[model samples]
Structure formats: C-alpha cells, structure tokens
Target: MVVGLREVAERAGVSVRTASNVANDFPHVAPETRRRVQAAIEELKYRPNTAARQLRRGRTEVISLVVPEISSPYFSELAAITVRVAAERGWTVHIDQTDGDADQERRMILGPAGRSVDGVLCSPWAVSPAELVELAAGPVVLLGERETDGVLDHVAIDNVRASREATLHLLARGDRVIGAIGAQPHLQNGTAELRVEGYRQALESAGLPFRTDLVMPVRSLHRPDGAAAVTRLLEVEPRVDAVFCFSDELALGALRTLLEQGRRVPQDVAVVGFDDIEDGRYSTPTLTTIAPDKTQIVRVALDRLAARIAGQTGSGAEAPLDLVVPHRLLIRESTTSVRTRKG
Candidate 1:
C-alpha cells in the first residue's frame, strides 16, 4: 500500500530520474514538469526517502548540536529551536550531550563528526582554547561563551556585559552586598569566569570593593548546586541583600533557599539570573533574567553552517567569524522597582 517514487513518476508521466530531482529539490527541471511531479506526489501521497535522497548528493544534510547538558532548560529550549529551524531547511540536527566532560568533547571534536555530519554547532565547556582553531578548520560553530581566538565560527552574547548589567540592576534597586553564584574556578570553562568578571566590574563601578567572601564557586549550574552555594553564602554573609546567578537554574535554587531562610525576594534579597528560562516566568516572585534570543542564535548558526558546507569561507556573504547575537534584561517581580534612586 506504499506509494513509492516510481509510482509517483508514472502518475506524473516523467522519468524516475526526473521525479527524483524534483523530490530531492535539485534544480533544472522544467517548470511544467515540476508542477506535474508535485501534483503527482500530492495525488499519490508519495513520501520521499530523505536519507537516500541526501546520500545521492554526497551529503547527509545532518548537523550535530553539541552541548554540555540538554536537560538544562536553556539548552533544552535552544535544542528545540535548532531542531525546528533545521527541519525547515531539510536538515536534521543530532544533539550530543557531553555533561561538560572534557574527554567527551575532545572525542566529539576529533572523532567521527567529519565523516557523519555536514557541520557542527557546539556549546563547549571543557575544550581547551588551543583546540578551538582546529575545531573551526572544520565546519564547527560554537554557541556559548568561549575564547574562540577569532578563528572559529562563534555565536554568543557578551557574557561579561550581560552579567554586569544583571548585577547593576540589583544594585540600582538598592541592594548591596550581592553574592555571585556559579563561579567555576576549578574548570577551564570561560563562561563562569566571564560572568564573575562582569559581576566584579559592576561592583567596582558602584564604588563597592570586590569581596572574596561574596563570590561563591559552584561545581555546576544546577538547582542543587545553587541551593547549596546560596545556603553557605547566607550562613556566612547573613546581610547579603542580592545575588546575581549565572543561570536561571541557579537563581531558582537560590530563590528557594532564600525564601526558606526567611528572606523575601526583592524586599530582603533581590535575585537576578541569566538564561531567561520559562520557569523563571512562573516562579514564586517571578525571576528577573537576561534573555538571549534563541531563535536568532539558531538561524544565524545554521546560516553560517550552510555557508561553511558550501565552502563559502572567503565569500563576502559569509558572516563574521565571531558573531554576537542580541540579549535583553527581562525584569520581573523578583527585582522591585528601584528601592532607592541612584545617580
């Protein structure tokens, strides 16, 4: 009961090769012939074998999206956008999670990707900077805060700027003694380091001295890590009035711990987070966060990848090697309107 390409061709009164060209969307078929084939396909309810079609073109039309953890809300939403966008262009996205493992990232970068996929979109955590240029010589584009050496095709917001903005928001709302959570001093990850730098910059600009006691290091950006780090922070710095978390997950966790410990959000301890995830919108006080434009990130990434696949590196149409997308600070109830106006 299956309607195959051969049947579709017969119904359209065209050769199988002609029908195939149409199905694969290869150019050069006469206009009338294309209409006939499309109509025949519709009438016969023909479904093309995508894999076989792509293989004939000497391409798989598949891309790998590598990330530290897809389970994270930020990454989950990003992967969803990537998959949806890739499908519109007749491509498939294979999501590969490394759990921030260096060895896994190394293997993925140096392993079967070249043979299996047309390109790669990665948000790397543990890969060394030296390996970044090598990653770019292939069709690899990074998705997050990484020191790409201007050689790799990278896409990310300015992490330092975003973090500074988040901190300044809390400060503007009359909250001082802010604790910074999610500093990964133990890892080679540039994201946490950049965020901490931004937090420090904001404090410095506010005439607040950088305090080592207020900067909390975390093993991960998960809720539990946030909960534990904030707990320890609260125990030591009982007067901490605000916290700028590196991720919404951490912020949510910190929010929970603060409320449980008798601190009211905004009134007592304002919270700001990055990665404006959906949960933030529905949290108790609703979270304030830095929202990166995920759809734009995926579109730009895929566009760059397509250019790379076509060997369009030197073409003037190619985008910048290090592209920065747009992000906005979304304010919510978690941060009250400036409790005290600042100059």
Candidate 2:
C-alpha cells in the first residue's frame, strides 16, 4: 500500500525525470510544474527512499555536526537545536565529538568518515581554520567563531563585541580593577584572543589601564579552570573588584572559589561571565552574563547545511545565510554593586 514516484509523477502530469528534478530541487524547472510535482508528492505521502535516492544521486543525504565537547551544555544545546532544524527539512544529523582533542579533530577531518557526509557544520576547538578549509571537501559551515575568507557558510556571534559589552556593563556599574579569566592554547578557535581584545577595548574606553597581571589564562573550559584562575587572579591582585569569565562554567568555578575564600559575591567582589547558561540562572546568586540567541544560531546553521546539501549557494540567497547574531547582557545578583560598604 506504499506510494511510488511514478504514481505521483503521473498524477502531476510529469515524467519520472521531471519528478526527480523537482525532488532534487534542480534549477530550470518551471515554477508551476515544480509546484504541481510538490503538491502531488505531498498528497501521495511519497517518502523518497534515501538509499535509492543516494544510489541515483551518489550522495548519503547526511550532514555531520562536529563539536569539540558534547558534554558541555552549550554545544549539546546547539546540537539539539541543529537536529531539530535538520529534521524539519527531511535531513538527518550525525553528531561527532572530539573532546577538544586536536588529534581526534584531525582524524575526523582527514579520515574517510569526513567524506561520507554530504555537508558539515562544526565548532572547531582543536582544528585550525586553515586545516578545516583544507579538510572540507564539500560545503562547510563554521559555528561559534568568526568566518575567515567566506570559506563556507557561517553562523556566530561576535565574540569581541560580546566580551566588550560584558566588560563595559561591569565598568558602567563603576567597577575598577577588573579581572578576567582567559583561555590558553588548551582551548580552541582564538576565543581567548577575541575576548581579550574586547576586555582591552572596554578598559581603554573607560581610560583604565590594561593590567596584564589581572588576566589569568586557564588550561580548560571547566569549573576547575575557573577556580584555579580565580586563585591566581586574587593572589596577583587581591583587591580586584570585578572578574569576567570566558564561560559560565568557569564563572561557577570562580564562584565556588570565592565562597571558599570567604569573599561575598557582589559584596567583596562582583563577577560576570559569558554564555548565559541554564545553571547560571539558578546559581546560589544568579550569574550575570552575556546572552546570545543560541537557538537561532543553531536553526540558521542547520538550514544552511540543508541548503548546501540541496545544492544552494552564494551569499544572501534563499535567506540571510551567513549570520552573526547579537549578544545582550543579562544582569543578575552575582554582579550587583561596584562598591562595598564596611559595617
């Protein structure tokens, strides 16, 4: 009782080739004809067999999403959104995690598995842009970072702007002697560089000197890194009034360290972080952080991959394809007053 392509083509008054063209979204088909074929296919509930389609088209009809750390809520949330979006377009998502390891990332890009996917959407923590560009044999979409040379479709927030805005928010509240938890080479994608630029810009704008000692570079994007970074920052500049963490996880770690050190948040020292994560909202004292449209970013990323898989191309075609979403400050209890009163 299954419907076939020939039945749908017959109902639409089109040849099998014409129906195939409509399904593949081949250009040059008349709009009216395309509409009729689409309508007939929908009415017949004709689900194209992926294996048959692949055999005919020489494609797997699969898009791969490569991330550095799947365990991180940020990446996992993004993956979830990407899957949902791809599913809507009759596409499937293949998720691969590299655990932020460079060798694993290299293998993913250079290995045969990379070639099996029709398109790729990735957040490279260990792979360099140059290497990514070389490894990409097909359409590649880079997320969570800036696009280099229009190498492929990209969807991201401006890290520099987001970081600067977060720093400025703290500065606006009269915070001086600001501290920042930075990332070392252990992390990826020049994130630390861009964020540091933002922090420096904020300080420059406020006529405050950029103190190198106040920046503590951490080895990872975990709570332990935050804790260790805080310890170093306090020891280097014990009287620091504010701290900006590169991520919410680090901020949580810093929060734990501050509590253990008997320093009250927003009282002894104010703290702010990037990535307005779920845990940040429900922390002991809610975390003040920068918020980006994560869901929207993922949605756009998946749509771009789908389009690329369907052979769509060029800038500003079919949709606003390349995206750099805006970021906003979400103030919370963690970053309140700039000054504390001694009783």
lDDT of each: 0.86, 0.82
lDDT of 1: 0.86
Q: Which stretch of 10 consecutive residues in model 2 shows the poorest summed lDDT?
A: 312-321
Best by TM-score: 1
lDDT of 1 by residue, 1-343 (tens): 8788999999999999999889878899999999999999999889977666667766778888888899999999999999999999989888889889988887776564765788888888887655754644358888877666766778888888998999999888878799999998877758898899999999999999899889999999999999999999998899998988999999999999998988888788899988999999999888999998899999988998888888844655454488888899999988974334345
The CA lDDT at 180 in model 2 is 93
Per-prediction TM-score: 0.85, 0.79
Clashes of 1: 0
User: Which candidate comes out best when scored by lDDT?
Assistant: 1
Question: What's the CA error at residue 112 for candidate 2, in Å?
Answer: 6.5
Pairing residues by index, what is the TM-score of model 2?
Answer: 0.79
Clashing pairs in 2: none
Give candidate 1 regions above 4 Å deviation: 1-19, 22-52, 135-137, 312-320, 337-343
TM-score of 1: 0.85
